[model samples]
Target: MGIAEERITRLHQLAHEATASGDFDLAREYVRLARRVAERNRCGLPKSFRRFICDECDAYLRPGVNARFRTQSGGHVVVRCDCGATKRYPY
Candidate 1:
């Protein structure tokens, strides 16, 4: 893979590790940096990372902690971030 792609992946990995270690703040910052790298390279964020990145505050979401997930009727899944952003995804 290219250097930019590798950097992006590394940042995402660090973000995941930070979240796993109960450091939500670092995880959020890592994700934000990863997004910047991706944008500078004109690339898209990974699918796995996309779900965890809050669209409103750009915070990294840890399910049940910083984010609340709800599966509603009518083929909708909602993710509510601590920043009061509600995102709906069609399942």
Candidate 2:
């Protein structure tokens, strides 16, 4: 993998390890670093350019309720489904 990809992977690993160890403070720091690296590498597309996919219906998420971003370990999005299921998309 390229340097950016390797860095991103390391960031995720660190964040995961921190969380698994119950070191929330360290996890947050790792998450912050991951976000910065992702932003710097232009890995995540802009909101307007992003294509939301519903994990349940396999359809495009309609907008508002389907969108939520978290600066967690690795990137994650919480999507509220019409079926009353809350699905998390992680990358």
Candidate 3:
């Protein structure tokens, strides 16, 4: 992995840790920083990282904590962030 990718991965871990510790603002900062790094490096964010972040509010989702996860009958998974942004992914 390149330096940018490594930094993003580290930031992802840090964000997860911050969220677990109940410091959501710090987690959001980490998420935004990681995204900026990826943009500057012209690299796509990791799939796991992309799925866990809200596109509208830039919040790191923690499933039931700040996001709701559901499976629809249409063969897709729906993730709704606390900010009311919803994302759908095929299963």
Candidate 4:
């Protein structure tokens, strides 16, 4: 993988660790930095990275921690961030 992609992945790992340790601010910073790197390198954020970040608040999500996950009858999964931003994706 390219340097930018590798860096983004590393940042993703750091964010996950930070969140797990309850350092949410650090995780948010990591997410922001990853996005900046992706933008500068003209590379799209990885799919998993995009899905795990809150588009409205820029927070790294950890399922039940600061976000909620639910399945709907509409045949899609919903992710609601603590900031109340909702995202839906097909299963």
C-alpha TM-score for every candidate:
0.88, 0.49, 0.98, 0.97
RMSD of each: 1.3, 12.1, 0.6, 0.6
Clash pairs, candidate 2, are none
C-alpha lDDT values of all predictions: 0.87, 0.54, 0.96, 0.96
Better of 1 and 3 by TM-score: 3
lDDT at 23 for candidate 3? 92
> lDDT (0-100) at residue 33 of candidate 4?
98
Which one wins on TM-score?
Answer: 3
| Greater-lDDT candidate between 1 and 3 | 3
**lDDT: worst 10-residue window of model 1:** 56-65
Writing each residue's lDDT as its tens digit, candidate 4 over 1-91 gives 9999999999999999999999999999999999999999999999999999999889999888999999999899999999999999998
Which lDDT tens digits does candidate 1 get at residues 1-91? 8888899889888987888888988988988899889889999888877988898787888888789999988889899999999988888
TM-score of 4: 0.97
Ranked by lDDT from best down, the candidates are: 3, 4, 1, 2
Model 2, span 1-91: residue lDDT tens:
6676678677666655665666756755765665577689888522321234333443334434334434456687666645555666566
In model 2, the runs with Cα more than 4 Å from the true position are 45-91
What is the overall TM-score of model 2 with all chains considered together?
Answer: 0.49
Residue 52 of model 2 has an lDDT of 41
